[model samples]
Target: MHNESIRYLIVPGWQGSADDHWQTHWQKSLPNSVRVEQADWLKPRREDWVGELQRVIAADSSPVILIAHSLGCVTVAHWAQLAPLDTLRQVRGALLVAPADVERANCPPALRNFAPVPEHLLPFPSQVVSSDNDSAVSALRAMEMARNWGAEIGILSGAGHINVKSGHQRWEQGFAYLYRLQGRIEQSARRRA
Candidate 1:
C-alpha cells in the first residue's frame, strides 16, 4: 500500500506524549494518523494496553504502521505476542523507539508489570530505535531487543530517551527513520505477492 493510504497508529508511553513531544508532533503533522487511546495511561495494565491496541487495529480497515515509544513499544510486543497471525498481518511494520526497561530494578511501579520482555521475532517487519545514553534502556539491552525481535536497530549519539525531556522535540531524524520503514513493508508485501 502507498504511504498515504496506510494508517499511522500512535502509541505513546506512560502518561502519553506531551504536547511538545515528538510523537505528538508527528500525530498532529502526519496524515492518516491516529493515537490509540488507553483507558488509563497513568496506571497501565498490560492487558488493558494490549487490548486497546488490538481494538484500534481491528476497528480500522486500512493497513497500519505502528509508531510506538517507550512503554508503548512494550505494549506492541505484548499485543503482537497474543494477536492471531491474520490480525498481525494488518500491521505492515513498526517503529519501536526507546523501549522502556520494565525488567530493570529501578523501573516505575506502574511500568513493572510489563516485564519479561517478549523475546520472539515479530511476524511483521520492525525497527528498534534507541539512544546511546537513554536512562530507561542501555545500548547492550537495546541491541538484544533488536536481535530478539528480528528487527533492525539504530542508536543515536547521546540522545537521552528520545523524548521531550531529551531535547528530541520535533525530531526530524526519527521521523525520517519511520518514513523509511514504509519501504521495508512495501518490499515485504511485494515479496509475498
Candidate 2:
C-alpha cells in the first residue's frame, strides 16, 4: 500500500488460512500487516475471536484496513457491530472475501455461534468479493450481503471459495481491488477532513 502509516489487519477464518492462502502471502509481504491471532482456530467462539480482534486494534494507533476471508469476514461484521465508536473509527475500510453465509440453513455446527451475522452497515467503507460458485455462499447471497452492508460487490466467475484449493495464490486481481479500496478510503478521509 502507498500509505506508509496505514496498518493492515489480517483476520483468517475457521482453522485459519493456510500457508498457500492469499491472506498469508499478503501478510508476509506487507511490512505493516499483522494477523489477529485467535485462541482457538479449530473451534472458534465469536466472542473470543471478536475480542482478539478488538484487542489487536486497540493496541495499535494507526488506521487499519481489514483483509478477511471466509469466517473471518463474518467476524469483522460482528466486530463492527460491537466495537466502540472510537475503535471503529480507526478502521479505514475492509476487504471481505468469500464470506460464509453463517445464517444459512446448512450452517456448520462450529460456525453456528456466528449465525445471525450483524445486519448493520459498517461505519467505514468496505467491499465484498465473492466467487460465482463458492460453497460457503452463492453469488446471489454474497451480493445480497454486500448490498445489505452498503459495500461495493465484485463477483468473479468460476472461482470456488477463492482459496488455495480453488487455485488462488498470490491473487493479483484481489490486490487490484485492495488498491482501489485504499484509494477510496483515503479520498473519503481527505473529504471528511
Candidate 3:
C-alpha cells in the first residue's frame, strides 16, 4: 500500500477502546490512523453508530482501510448500506476482528436486538477474524457471517470476543492479518492499474 492513499480507520465496539486495548495501541502506533468517535459509548443505538461512522468517512480526505472489532464490525456493515455509492467505493479494505454478526445468538442480552445481519458485502477486499472459543458469538456463526459477507476468514484458537477483557493485548497475529489485507488491497490496485 502506498503511504499516500492509505488511511487507517479503527472502530471500537460498545464501551470504546480502553487505554490498554490493542486497537488503541495500534491507532497510536500507526500513522494516519484514527478511531471513529461515537457520541455515546455506553449505550449503542444502531443508527447512532452508523451516523458516527458516516461522519468519519465523509471527513476523510482519502480512501480508507477499516479495522473494526466486535460490534464495530457490525456498525461498519450497517453503515455500508447507507453510505453513498462513491463513498462505499472509496473504502479500500477492511479487517473485521471478532465480528459479532448474529448478535442475537449468544451475546449480551442488550445486544440481542442487533439481529437480522445486514446483507451488505464490502465492496473492497476484507477479512473477518474469529475465535474458536468466543462465547459471545460462536465460531460457527463467525464463519457463517464471513461467508455471508464474502470475506476471507482467519480463525484463532481461544480468544474470547478478541477484546481486552478476553486478555488480548498487542495482538501480533491480528496486526499481521491487517498487513495481509493491506497487501490484498495493494494487489487489487495493481490489477486495476
lDDT of each: 0.91, 0.91, 0.83
* Model 3 lDDT tens row, 108-138: 6555555667766767788999899887677
TM-scores, all models, native as reference: 0.96, 0.97, 0.94
Return the lDDT, model 2, position 65: 94
The runs of at least 3 residues in candidate 2 whose Cα sits more than 4 Å from the true structure, single-residue gaps closed, are: none
Of the pair 2 and 3, which is ahead by TM-score? 2
What is the C-alpha lDDT profile of model 2 across 8-50, one tens digit per residue?
A: 9999988898888999999998779999989899999999999
Model 1, 1-193: lDDT tens digits are 4557788999999999989999999998888999999989899999999999999999977788999999999999989999976679889899999999899878999999999899989888999999899999998999999899999999999999999998989998887788678778878778889
Which is the leading candidate under lDDT?
2
Q: Arrange candidates by lDDT, highest first: which order?
A: 2, 1, 3
State the lDDT at 20 in candidate 1.
95
